[model samples]
Target: MKRKFLLLTTFCMMVLAACAPGGGSDSEESNAVSGDGGSGKQVLDFWYIDPGEKEKVYQEAVERFEEKHPDVEVKMLRVANDAYKQKLAVSMSGGNAPDIFNSWGGGWLKQFVDQGQVLDVTESIEKERFNELALDNTTFHDKIYGLPLGLSLDLVFYNKEIFEEYGLTPPETYTEWVEIIETLKENNIIPIALANQTKWPGAYYLMNFAARIGGPDLFNEAFLREGRGFDDPAYVEAGEYIQEMVEMDAFNPGFNGVPYDEGQGRQLLYSGQAAMMDITMSLVNNVRTEAPEFEEKMDFFVFPTVEGGQGSNKAVGASTGPVWSVAADTENPDLATELIQELTSQETAEAYTNRTGSLTAVSGVEPEDEFVNRMYQVAEEATHLQMPYDQTLPPELAELHKDTTQALFGLSITPEEAAEQMEAKAKEVLE
Candidate 1:
């Protein structure tokens, strides 16, 4: 499967490159100019990754801003997800960054903040309007550097049709979840759709599981302590659980090699080959687009309660989606702030949520997509929204988390070994 995905990706890249007029030598810098004719309106540049069909929602907000402010012109750049971070980094280093750009909550933005490249939005915006978890994510060193536009919770998305076919409902506890997997196996169906080859997706699942077993507070304590090891009993327990599932053949064949695109893990659920998948709320949109016929059969639920675990039954993993931040050196700071306000306002939030089936960071804006709305409802009910470990921990430690988790699946090491490694890496980073 890895070979197949690689070939497909390579082929697509070649075709796209051939079709384009130029190679990938475009400068990352934005040519934005602020200040309207002499004393006119200000112009701002905003950069973000394409959010499926929600581009127009953002454009409309910019239009509204222009109408109200008349003197301001907003330029929007839709960058690819893989290119956004690197491009923004380059632009920042060159001192030609966009007025506003998207950024992750953790290390990605941390590096910029450390370099004094991002503006602190906490002072300009009212953080109360956003979810507490979302706000917490952007807050670093007692200052918030960005405004969250959306959020994503890591949860289990199951195929209603598949579940019903196998006489299963969303499991309410980890024990039940294990039973459901066994039942699915009995019926010759894969219990989970996992695309471990993409690496990040698998990491999310591991983080979610570990958080549940260790409990958010304890997990965070371990993550923040230097010389703390990943080989903690709780961490090992989570890894062993995942490894057990892998050994049971709960995932689709070759799942470890499937990339995110090409419908990899999702394909299993859509095709009725798998019963469940652990993924972000965005999967609802993907399912709607790629398998509309199965749309009605799709549903989601929080990860089941871990038996005898320290985590609360309602504990769930989540993170603020990429946020919009302004370059500290922007020629027009006020214009950039205004653009952010417009972009994350109630109207734009609603439109983006409705168009992309995403949960908005803005309060009081309900998601229009039923599945997404349901996810938000469940997430809100959770006692705690534990940020995914990868996003909450330092980058170096996060990578170790992923590597050890993957190693567990490959049976190269026991869960104890993996946890020990995680602890060692966490300690090094935290100290």
Candidate 2:
């Protein structure tokens, strides 16, 4: 949800180039691939942030790509999660960037796009080939800059067993949701499990609350420099609602101490330490593999709608965060474009869904994983698929939003005060 660069220093680039782990062509030391047709072949450098077996899937795809285009060779680089962004920043703005790289097309990508680091491949791609929701972040100013690889949705994943024990069903409205939370508390059960150690998880609540209160347009309008801004009544009301939930002790005890990614939050849900969790759809695989019994007990529901709010009940919180973008400085734009096209094609989407048990952005590929398939259905029914506010806003303001949202959850700042802080920050950065 957070990313950017102050400046891509030459020293930083050098460091990244030296330290980055190389894949594909074992002979290539750096990404400055030669495009000379003297050998009747072109070489392209690609960087990706695939943490596990995804790299293996991509490797197979690269092999298939090589077989298809015998004259083009791809120099793939696999970077670890922690270092990928900074390395990518340096490689893009300071030095010769890879011909293509993995990106999340949002305000983070906007910075690179503004610096002319990424290419506009509008004509190269078919806009209708992708889900419009996934494509939301891929375009800027009516031009496409990237291709969506996968889709992720955030919903409340609850332990159905726990719910049944408490005679609970998924709530359809905000008031019902609050009553359920209160019921869970009275029964000495934690209603929602929260983990704010990384901050984005907490920000999800704020984003969804705002979306339900103001509908999809309000946040977009505010971020696009409209009159509403961060001081909009809806955002403040979201914060106020969050504060009220916190005051009611709806979240797990010591939730602020739990980290989201390091197995803490997921552990809480699967172990029955908590009844429900707001989680990204990608966790289905992990839940499937690690806790099959728990998986059977798990089911998700979209965040409930506000009773008299502007947003529709169908507006679910989802994002197409990871995208593959071609670098602007690539010598072989045709080859780079073709490669990304193939990677995001219908066949590849099906292959990726099969291999990873996740959903891809390509419209036709129905994921084999049942949970992911259901999530795909959820995305299809959405009136508006909203990206996390922290990802949609400009870099600095996004960070501010995350921090203030976390603070709101922690009860350190009142909702009005949080809105005031965000308005001041947004004015400084945008105005």
Candidate 3:
């Protein structure tokens, strides 16, 4: 099995190298919002990356928040996902950062925390109120910097109707998983609906596979230079697993060219052209919103265990959804803290979950929707919820990881080569 992958690696790399490193994000204008919007009320500018239905939910929450405060006004600014980091950086540098902003809680937020740009809200938030897994990224050096808004886990979401038609049950091991993929292919069905054109979508495979092969501590040890680092055999082996799948036609045709944000792969699932999707739990909201009828047919299973692997089957690839943190320089720390509390309060948590069909990090909030309940359970059961590499690693190394992983999926780089590239960069940056 591995020999086949070794034989295909060089050839695939040569054939696809020229087409790697897909396009960039479209430049967007971001105006620095001031805390004083000219209103007499105590104004608080809040920036977040949610733009559509999520914005609506936040707006409703803000309305209630206003109703409670009466004298304070919250200004909500929705920023584009790709443009947000730069926007926040610019605003923070200009000393006009929002009172509170949503941030991914790993290396992304750590930089701000290190620079004293983020407030340590440890006293403001009750540590016992959130799931420990959700707090992993936000807590640095024994202090919490942000409040997690939601929890997102990556798992294999399958179409129950399609599974029933084929008499297939979710697999519990890697070998069984491959059998399912092969079986799907035999029937001319796409085994997995993956949109790798954006790069990050495909990195999940490598992350989850590495977690299963090397267990939870592999990446962290490698990242901190305690172990073999990125050249760890687990990473290479994970890459090999991905390539084997690519050679076996596990993903859709032209998967390297499909963009996830455009809903291409999801469309396949919606049409039943694909059997399963190993994607984020956020897909729950999209399905419930755009294809409500399909919700009943959808269910998920955790990524299967690998034969003789050191990792637990319960380990998960997960990230806390945008966590809200107060700016360290805010003049009204008390008011800002109160607003953060209001936003992630029990009422808002329930409202957010109800409106989005997603799991909030708030403890004791069970999603009424059955499918989302499964996602919630998976998050609960996760022994090691690994944050995505791009978020957990520094910006430059993170980009390299995505690019090389994308190249790996495109088979434009051999597993060994990809691992080597990552190790070299990690050494340069971290050492």
Name the best candidate (by TM-score): 3
Q: lDDT score, residue 369, model 2?
A: 73
* Candidate 2 lDDT tens digits, 1-431: 12335344656887787766544233332444345544757888889876454566677778889999998888889886446777998766655688989977888888888888889999988899998868878899899999998888888999899889989999988899998999888888788988787788888888888988988788878877875778889999999889888999989877777876577778888888788888777667667566767878989899888867888768877777459999887888998998998788777778777766677888888877787678778877777888877666778898899889888988988899999999899878887
Q: Pick the candidate with the highest lDDT.
A: 3
Model 1 global lDDT (CA atoms, 0 to 1): 0.77
| Regions more than 4 Å wrong, model 2 | 1-43, 50-56, 69-83, 186-188
TM-score attained by model 3: 0.87
lDDT of 1 by residue, 65-118 (tens): 888887677878998764666788787887677888887687667878889998
387: Cα error in model 1, Å: 1.1
What is candidate 1's TM-score against the reference? 0.85
**In terms of TM-score, which candidate is stronger, 1 or 3?**
3
TM-score-best of 2 and 3:
3
lDDT of 3: 0.85
Please, what is the whole-model Cα lDDT of each candidate in the order they appear? 0.77, 0.81, 0.85
Number of backbone collisions per candidate, in order?
12, 0, 0
Ranking, lDDT, top scorer first: 3, 2, 1
